[model samples]
Target: MTTLARLDQFARERKRAWAEGTRRAAKIARERLRSACERAGQRLWRTLSRARHERARDLSKRVQHGQRIVKVGREHGMNVAAATVNLTRKAWRRVRGLRRPFVRAGRRVERLGEQYGALREEWAVERDIESLVDGGEPILFGPWTSEVGYEALYWVAFVRWVKMTYRLRTDRLAVMSRGGVSAWYADITPRYLDIFDRVTPEAFAARTAERLVSAGTAKQMDLSAFDAELVESARRELGVERLRVMHPSLMYRLFRQFWLGHRPLGFLQSHTSFARLTMPAREVRIPDLPAEYVAVKFSGAQSLPPTPDHQRMVRRIVGAVAERYPVVLLDTGMAVDEHGDFGIVRTPRIQSVREYLRPSDNLGVQTGVIAGARGFIGTCGSVAWLAPMLGVDTQAVMTDARFLHAHLHAARWVYRTLDAGRFSPLDLGGFARFGLDVAGASELLADRPS
Candidate 1:
């Protein structure tokens, strides 16, 4: 255990300790690598299994949808086949001279004629017209054509006649309308016809039948056989001895062809008088509305196509307005197919008016909602035409220029025609004037009539 022997033993011990440390480090590294590989394999398997499950579910849904479609198609085909068989049988009967029974049955099934006769008797008993008239002629005014807006316009001629001639007794006047006029039409007519007593189509038809029976002409009369005959009967029953029966189509033609052109003076005077007489106030309601809300109606009979650009523009306008006031989207639920296309997306500030109001609501309720709104925004449709009549401040975004001047003079409202092809600049000047600012003046422009 001299100095040289001690040094050699210590060096050997140090080298042995280093070799043992290296072996332990290698074992630890191998265990760590094995665990990492196992975890990676588990994650890969899970991802593959999840993807497979989703694919299977999607396939099953597609198969079920296909089956439903096929079933519907089969039912529809069966219905068509049944209809074809019935039609074929009728055609065969007609060819084989065996259609007499069907023809006789059809003749006996004149519900309108029978109903008309019954209605006339009921009216005669209820009204006591013979006593009420007291030798004065009772005048019946209508059998008004169905289009509500034009029906309102047609009344102008009668109003003009009353103003000019002063012969027809307003007190003895009764205005007739066909059944099933919309609540809107019913609500609106009072403004113009409140002066005259009203009669329904049933009563008018009944009266006509009574007259025909009295004249000994009702035996085999079919009122629906000829339009001219119907018109003549209406005139005779209504006691329209000399006054001409004017149809809405005739009025429209006259307005387009003559009244708006060379014969403008009389037309202008009459329409101006009509406007003065017919304007009435409307009140609307919004349930749980915020302090400020803007009502918007975009889809209608003349709605522009819901292209991507149009959708973007709508969103931009709605988004811009929503920042200042809650926006209520008013829709009639007519455009179910275009809902996804025209639906406002990404704006939390807009709500559907349909959520609060139903389609079945009366026209008064509908008009009140539009009239009560702080501001109205819509396309050039019935609602747009109505907004101004209700005295609501309105802004109309129009696609067609033809309607720009059609009823512009009827009421006051801001109208803007947009080019559907391009991204027309958002002009917020109108909204700004109304105290609504979505991106300042860059959002909308207040368009003026030319």
Candidate 2:
């Protein structure tokens, strides 16, 4: 029974107790960790389920909102369509209401036309030289009165010249222009160019007012009424009972289609007719131009201003020509001043005739200036037309082949040669290198009648 044996047994017992405690603690720790992990998993699953439910609810709400919007849009579209249809129906009904009156008016017009058989016969009468001269005072009628200078000079003046060539008395003739005639045209000689500065309706009303006044019904009158009286007085004074009215537009249309479109017909008929017509007497005195200066005209087509490229090419051409002869730039009165739209500054080396010749300058004076030029260069336009008529040796620069063909007579007879053809780009360097043949230009200038 020794104390050491008893102590050994006690130690073994303590070791066993310690081992059991450790085992128990380890088991408890493992159980706690397992429980915590299970709780965490449950919480995660609940959170995930809530999130999924929220997303589903949000998606459903969005889909419902979209459906509601689509329904509203469809309703709105239907309403707009219904409103449009109703409006269209109302307009159609209104139009139908107006159709009867228009039909009646048309019938009345046709009846009136039928009644005026003699007038139709007279209108159908072909204008011969004898008829034009002895028929009576020639009356020129134009739909557009406010024509550009070139149009007035070429078309209007040409028609007037044609009438004059037939020996029509200029003093007795009356020109009826609808809308106000341009000042450039109004300044032309013979004093028979009467511009009906008002519309046809106004003119008719004025004439009625005049008749009423003459019948002693009205004592006082307005300006328009006075104009009518003046017109009537002039007609009586000129001893013109009925004027042989010439429709310039109709003539021009026919000229373009039949006269200009057909090759030899235009040259033989229109051009030859124009040649036979003597130039109208000009009241405006033309200033003397430079003795040997080259005349250059640069302008664009109707309503369109010359492009920068065009101006630059013209400048280059002028410069090259100026090297040989003094260059004079002729303003067509439709010249567009480039307000430095292009970055390059173009200072024309040649002298501008614009300072001398104004927009209001007489067309005769303008023509005279063109005629006096030694060598003429111009764009394919009215000026080019005039050069041929004047027998001036010229070079015409055309942008389009159609335009050149349309004015074949001018292209052939007017210009000595074509400067640039259709589709020729306005390259300054190219033009500078391909300078105008100095000798050819000189020959043209020398050959031109002073």
Candidate 3:
């Protein structure tokens, strides 16, 4: 019997024996941590913002410098993501490999078998152990947590750790065990191995905003908006002619489907302060979403406000861009539900071409779904964030002025407009021009001393 299996059996027997206050003990621990984080965050914020009226440039320069250095390092193959993946994989393998005589629920001792028969067929016992150690065991956290707040914190740390260290996002493994959707194997990266040790709630929030918000003006920008300099910079470096793109869609279905195989633990603890603290952290990653994505007006009796002509206008603009580019996807995720209804139906223009896909199909399968798109277009949604992380040139068009300042980083372009009530199609030529700008900036920056 493997040592781990033996230990697991022992532990399970112990749990069954005590079976009384185990859950209560865990709850108490969670509540304490939540309160601690909240109080700490408030204290930190008061201290950090006490400075004199400093120009935003000071902060931008420092942040941008750090981001750029990280990017450059990745280009040279210094991967924090790979390391994290390896570390977690290693830890997990050990946990899964020890053979043990499992005490069955019916009271008989049976040889505990591999969780996955397929894996057993392919790998010898030792080889399987190696895989687990290298890849770490995925701990599916959903069937929503009993403690939603703590779940949120865990997710925040997990996502940030991966992004910061590996420059890659976590690939969620979905499961269908608990209720509707849940995570099966949520991998932790090295970047986040000791996150709780280094982060307080305030720092976590700041870093989150820094990661999720796009770079530009202090206020949020609409999806169509762009920072001329940022685009020009990317264009100059990558060569304008070579960069191609399609309209942007958030690929909501792809992500939802990816999580389908996972579990969602119900709220595990009850702490209002903890909930409040993690909400902002989650919000930072969510980005300043558009009203249409946020709206869920249905057809016929379910309809409301006619989708504000502006939303349709936005679609038309996206359609125009898609026609000119290799691929264009509209992020209609705000209206998405488990049933696949996105409230607003696609316009004839968008439906006819047949390139539109749910986000899950495009991103999770690990094949050539989005591999070919040269550029990405959208509001500051996950797809936009992900495209740049994957190294695609993206122009995140934000209709809301507030989004421009929202801390979205790594995209090749950013565009916004002042007209809030109206939806104006971002000029395809404008985005093309922006790409040129980005390329140019890249060249200039490249020549500078490292």
Candidate 4:
């Protein structure tokens, strides 16, 4: 109300307005300069196409080399890998039509008093759970429309946390997921709703491809139309008018900060429980293999990408394992996701159980085989995470681990914390050093890439 206070407020307003006007002017000037440079650069690039192409090729080779370095070590390049998080994101923005995919989520959290943006996300997660708790209807815990590895590693563990945090009984729960992974949820619930029961495999696969194209990432963050249909189908099957759903998006949002390095591992530790995965009952009829065959399910995607050299490495490793024990390849025999199987090696003592696998029970059959196996060897990002919890010694293979560094870091700690099976990762360059004390170790080392 005083004249001096009013004068001070007016001066502050004038200074803020001047600062805004200066920022706008600077932005316009920079935009004009960038436009002029782009026009000039286009002409120059066309004239020196060969040089530009060579420069791009050099950068590509460097990226490939760095990918190999990440592949060989068990998260050896974590510091460098984490450093590239922002750089890689900017690179993605630079790519044609990638600005949308790389854009930050539309979450408005500035008012939530976030210490590293935790409060808002944690609040959102709790709100979702609160809805499920408030609803007296039967709660559906999935239609787990994501990778099996994520289902086993993160989704199931998150559900366990919810159950423990709320003290909910299994009788009120039902899980919806693909393949007959009912056994994975046996501890949590007896009711397992199969997505395959509602949608055909061909239709499910096509819809999933469309969903990925829309979301711009493999993790299912949004509820797609197909996802809604699956939920509706489950309701119809159960003869329920309404169903309370706990979707995978909650799990994705909760721990995403830790993955992005905005939050520490303790944040995830406080939110989710990382208990070891219990073996699913092997009631499904699996292939009659040797009493103690090694289960192998390597795919040429994500971690162990498909390349001629990588395929050769897979053959050599599988051949070495076969020399000691019979090998059972856990190929799904169909395109389940973006991952492509490493194909069957024609080497002696190797058998693929792909034929016996049905869409309805493919995951169940695989679980049964893996739980019964003496050990497991596969791609680092897939069952490697699950196999450790399955109580089977796992030799996870990967030619490049650029995208799996954080996941690998978490897996190491979880396995150690749970006192589960020994998880050993074999990198692209470490093939020569793998299983050196075991039978046929010399052959594996001798044939490794020099």
lDDT of each: 0.45, 0.46, 0.30, 0.73
How many collisions between residues are there in candidate 4? 1
lDDT of 1 by residue, 278-380 (tens): 1222433455655556767665223444665455556666676776667767654432121222566434677765554432332334555655566677655
Index of the highest-TM-score prediction = 4
Better-scoring candidate (lDDT), 1 or 3 = 1
TM-score pick, better of 2 and 4: 4
For candidate 4, give the lDDT of residue 202.
82
Residue-wise lDDT of candidate 4 within 1-450, one digit each (tens)? 899999999999988996898688669857865775576556445545544565577567657855665575435555666647845764554453322322221121222224424645666676678668654588888778778778877788888788778778777788899888887777778889998877777888888888889988778797778878888888887788888888888888877777767677677677667665566435557646677678888887767677886777777777777777788899876886888888866555888888888888888888888887788888887676887787888877776777777777778888889898888776764553463332253254223311
Any runs in candidate 3 off by more than 4 Å, and if so which? Answer: 1-138, 143-309, 326-368, 403-406, 409-450
Q: Per-candidate TM vs. native?
A: 0.41, 0.44, 0.27, 0.70
Angstrom error at residue 3, model 4: 72
Point out where model 1 deviates above 4 Å. Answer: 1-247, 258-266, 275-286, 300-305, 335-348, 355-362, 409-442, 445-450
Q: Please, what are the lDDT tens digits per residue for candidate 3 over residues 1-450?
A: 999999999999887865556466557757865775566566545433432123244455545755666677678777788755755665465444321212121122111122123223322322322332233223221122111111222333333332333233343221111111111112332211112223333443353344235543221122222222222333343343322111011111112212232212221111001111101112111222221111111121111122344345344444444343322233323222111222334543332112332322222211122223344444333333333333334443433333222122111122121111111222223333455333332232222211
- What are the clashing pairs of model 4? 143-176
User: Which 10-residue window of candidate 2 scores lowest in summed lDDT?
Assistant: 335-344
On lDDT, the leading prediction is: 4
